[model samples]
Target: MPPVWDPAEAPVGDVGAALLMVDARIKEIHEPEDESEDGAEAERGELNRLFVASAGAEGVQELLDGTCTLLYMFMQWLRRTHEHGDKDVIEYVVPPLVATLRMMPRSVRPQTVPTMVALVVAAGTQVSPNGWRSQYGDWTPEEMNALEATVFLVAEHINRIAGDHNFAVRMIAETLTRVETDGD
Candidate 1:
């Protein structure tokens, strides 16, 4: 027998209902107790059914919309965290940040560069030896350097995106000028 659906597994919030529905379908198709050979075959059949069902679900559209919104918010958070000199947050968020930067569409690339540059500048400006200690704990200098490399990669991505938009180039230039003048 397939597992019963449970709405509780759905993430609560903007995309919660859709995620929950997907989770319920996944659970129904792959119950923990269904370990037998026959169960495996049944699981495959259930998976196919789930694919078809999900393809037609309004939930999937909601999920996609939610994901895009979350991604934008996450980028904003990263920018703020960097501005606050929160190395701990950067250390924890780097991997996902890099992944998001890499996967974002070219259309959004220009808008994303400033945040990425801000994150790198923030990471480089860490003044407290213990600031990153809580999160990275025992990370070697090499590990920290690797994180810097990721920041550099994001910077390059920003540059690539800026090349595609004249407005982005002007905006970035103006922002850089403001930062430079404000520092004086």
Candidate 2:
């Protein structure tokens, strides 16, 4: 569990190394300390406090902002480092990437959904022209369509949020745009 990105310094590094660092930290965050009930309860309490403390109505927005920034950084890492429309990217990279993206709380869904949309676009390109269901044995059309709709709604919500909070939205949107345009 080495530090992925030092909060003191800006986010800058080798993309592959950064991805590995972020993956490691996510694993560490999710890992169980002890199997005992007491340990589990303690862990839950600590995580809840962290979530709540960041999510408070007053002056605690930085905590939530920091978490969102890190999540966006992970998305930027993947988009900049990985080749789009590659089979291995679809198989190996996307599953864990999606899982990590899911770690962001629902409160930040507006900020995170565009990343998810980017992932879907990348992954969708990898599926067979006939359909993804045939290529990927387990996925159903209904499920995929539902996910598409959900992502669309989330993106719309992001637009709505951006309309109100232009400053924060502009910051994140610009970073995402830069990552998409610039190569590593």
Q: Output the number of the lDDT-best candidate.
A: 1
The C-alpha stretches of model 2 lying farther than 4 A from their native spots are 1-32, 37-39, 50-55, 84-184
How does residue 51 of candidate 2 score in lDDT? 52
Whole-model lDDT values for every prediction: 0.39, 0.38
* Cα lDDT of model 1 by residue, 1-184, tens digit: 1111111222222333322333343344345554555666567558646854775545443443332222233334445545577555455455555566556444235344344434343333332112222233443433323332333343333334345322222333465468679999
User: Can you give the lDDT of residue 125 in candidate 2?
Assistant: 40
Residue pairs of candidate 1 with colliding backbone atoms = 10-20
Cα RMSDs, all models? 21.8, 16.7
TM-scores of the candidates in the order shown? 0.26, 0.31
Global fold similarity of model 1 (TM-score): 0.26
Give the per-residue lDDT of model 2 (tens digit) for 22-118.
3333334345455554666467458646755675543233332233233344333334434443333334444544554456443334444444445
